[model samples]
Target: MSKAEIQTTGFFTEREFTCWRERDYKNFYPCQVSKQEGNYVSLSLGDMSYRFDDTIAEDIARCILDADLVTAGKLYGYIPKPAMRESAFDSWYKMNSSGVWNYFGEGEFSYYRSGGVIIFMERVTDEDDTAEIMGIYTIDDVGIKLVLESSSYSFSKLDAVWLSNALMEALGEEPLDFLKTSTM
Candidate 1:
């Protein structure tokens, strides 16, 4: 067994140990890694001890580090309310108050709100009529603003993805495969 030490920063300083196996399993197991203080590393399928070479260990460590950074940055993968515009709030409020604007254009549409973030999804009547995420908006003291627009990469899609997952979890529905209609 090979072992390596990993150092991480932010919030606090910590040391992590990675015990590696000589053989490669072709896939990283225990798919989900834990963040329980000292238990920061994930193990492969065959061992109780987290085993991986420095390369794999570093990869896992990077993921853990990134997650920590996201948390530190207060970016838990969703639009923050302070980032929303008044127009978006009005639109959302109108839809919710009357419950009559659920359908728009050629397909059905719905919106989900959590914290300060709002996600809009639509099922277009075009060729690929699947329900696709349209945009992610945020509301704050400054009003509402579009945080993630489906057609461009100017914004982080991770927040939108997080919102979508949250929606699915709340509705007890299967994961939805949102179509990317952006021609760009």
Candidate 2:
């Protein structure tokens, strides 16, 4: 949220992702590295949190990173970037100009797990047109598919970035640096 937080939460380091995975799937308490006691590293997720020894902490991190790579892969696929600028622009214009805004033209990227795999779906609707891209990945396979609900429309990359950042934050990471511009 703050500049400091952004600096600390920059793109998923293997360590951060591992930490997130541990917390999300294993229900390991989220914690920040604090101090070290011989072979053990102390961690505190929050006030009144339990401290873990180094061995347990390492085990938790390993479990988190070891979780099926499907979810992580899907997450990576949703990072909207320069390549998607044109599509994003087109979608924004259509949504704004079309009278569909009165009835629909809403955009959303919903994430959930099904059958032990993670699914990330982007649904956008405008009047008679709709575009949906869904990313489904599991430990064994990964795929990104387009499902046309009606006519056709483009998904907004900006929306994708927003959704991606939201997911990262939800996983205890910092917001993305996609839009940040250096003043110098």
Candidate 3:
């Protein structure tokens, strides 16, 4: 069985949105990388989705800064509301909170979703990228799950495609067909 690792303790990827509700603050919802062009990006977070397109800015999309997350040019998809799931730790808010409210450090949380997602993207061997270990998870006060391929995840076909693309994004290179999955 594979083991899961804790990449963070809180929701690091979630940004404060004007359309967010109270309950939608905690926990991380799985997201699919629907699209990722030069200056355009899109993600499907089940109940809701996010898209960024800086037509005026070229390669600056990847140069996403903290301030850009909230003030950047964004487009809310799927119902214009955040998915329902209260977060135990709102790292985004906490990290940005006043010195008194900055309870958690930035690395303590993840920004990938599910509080923040921990993506296992290690090359199996140092020789090449042919064999690799890959997994996605969330770790918070709930405890940590650290292992490789220890759990089974059911993914949709579209999800598989997008996740593969996401893995590539994680690697900062070409996407790979690493995640073998089944349709939901």
Q: Looking at candidate 3, what is the lDDT of residue 69?
A: 24
**Candidate 1: stretches off by over 4 Å:** 1-47, 75-184
lDDT of 3 by residue, 44-133 (tens): 444444332322111111111211222211212111122333322122323223222111101111122233332322223344333323
| Ranking of predictions according to TM-score | 2, 3, 1
Per-candidate TM equals 0.19, 0.24, 0.23
Worst 10 residues of 3 by lDDT: 101-110
Counting clashing residue pairs in each candidate, in order, gives 12, 2, 19
Per-residue lDDT, model 3, residue 19, is 15
Q: lDDT by residue for model 1 over 99-137, one digit each (tens)?
A: 222211111334343443333333334655433333323
- At residue 140, give the lDDT of candidate 1: 20
Winner on TM-score (1 vs 3): 3
The digit string of per-residue lDDT tens for model 2 on 1-184 reads: 3435534544221112122223235332222343222443322222322223333333223222222222233446431222222121122111124221111112233334445323333333444433333221112122111121221211122222332333344344554535432211
Q: Each prediction's Cα lDDT score?
A: 0.26, 0.28, 0.27
